[model samples]
Target: MSEGAFKKYGKRTLVYLFLILMSIISVFPLYWCFISSCNNTQQILGGRMVPSTHLIENLKNLFAQQDVLNAFKNSVINTVLVLVLSLAICSIAGYGFEIFHDKGKDAVMAVIMMSMMVPFVAILVPLFQMFTKMGFVNKYIGYILPSLSTPFLIMLFRNNARTFPKEVLEAARVDGLSEFGIFVRMFVPMMRPTFAAAATITFMNTWNAYLWPKVVLQTPDSITMPMLVANLLSGYVVDYGVVMAGVTICTLPTVIVFFILQKSFTEAVAGAVK
Candidate 1:
């Protein structure tokens, strides 16, 4: 090869190496968790890496100690509801902010973006009080409702909405379609990639929510998988094997969701870059 071509190849090689290193660093903890979960308590304590025959035993122990199945069910329900409702609300809000020619729309969008800067803890007390008054304490609504007005998700949708084709809206209007009908039929189908990315993100966040769920869901039955994982460690004594098993189980659904949506997610990202 020419010297310049060799130099270009070397740069590409370095980039690939750097990406591989980063990938290993990111995935190592999850790999360790899975391997550790397969081992017995003694094996885990001894830092065993190779798979052991005790995985079934550890799984049994996990189920015996934590009602993880019930928590998993609750997580699935809460995540699905939040994902559907948030996408609908945020996407519509985004469409309005994008299509409608309102003078104050940009200011409203800025205010919404600024709301995301406030720390969740700062509003915890007021949020708790509001939830109490609204009668959402210890209910699924408590878990689902708090996530509906996600400014970040709305911002994501709005940014994606800017890339939407305007001619379709004009054509739909000429066809005598209502504004809502135009959005529902034309805009939504075209924005599938954006929706997929948003769904993956929102589902993961809802599924993994711990602190707010723990605070509002006072009842044992209302608890989620993350809460169940936290409950695994009692004061001093911690069961390493069962905890690892529980974590692995908790992580599975998010991984599945990502894989399912990965194509659209990648397209959305690439489109944004373009």
Candidate 2:
């Protein structure tokens, strides 16, 4: 090879090596958590990063706790509900903003964007008071209702919809399709990738949600995974093994969902760019 070509190849090889190292470093924590979850209390305390023979024991202990199962079920339900509701609502709103633009709609979009800038913590007190007054505390509706209209998700959908071909919608219109019909039949199928990306993100957010669930869900049965995990850690003597198990349980669903939808997630971003 020529000297210039050799030098360019060498630079690219070095960059690839650096990226591989960075990726390993980023994933090491998750690997360690998995290992720790399989370890016994003694192994964990000894700082062992390898799997121990205590995996069965840890599983037994986790399942022995009655509340753990209930918490797991509640978390699953909440996560699924939130994912479905948020995705549907956000996608529809996003499509509307992009496909049916008007002066009023533009103004509404601006307001939604501005709402995203408001710190969630800033509204917590008022939201709590409102929920309390409305008798929504300790209810599933309290948990789900507040998150149904996420501004960030709406923005994500709207931004993605910008890349959708206007001609496609026009053709649907020419074919005597109503706006809702076009959205349901044509737009949704075409936007699968974007929807997958949005679903993965929203599902993760809802699954890992802690503060809101903790505040709103007063009853043990209604508490989501993160809230349950927090409560487990709140005990005076924290059981690291049990806590790690809880963390794994709480994380597995989102991880599985992400892996399942990863192709769509990438395609969605690619479609948006196109």
lDDT of 2 by residue, 72-122 (tens): 888778878888888899899998998889999999998888897798889
Candidate 1 per-residue lDDT, tens place, 117-139, comes to 89988988999999999999989
Q: How well does candidate 2 match the true structure in TM-score terms?
A: 0.87
Clashing pairs in 1: none
TM-score of each: 0.89, 0.87
Off by over 4 Å in 2: 1-20, 263-274
Q: Determine the backbone clash count of candidate 1.
A: 0
Clashes of 2: 0
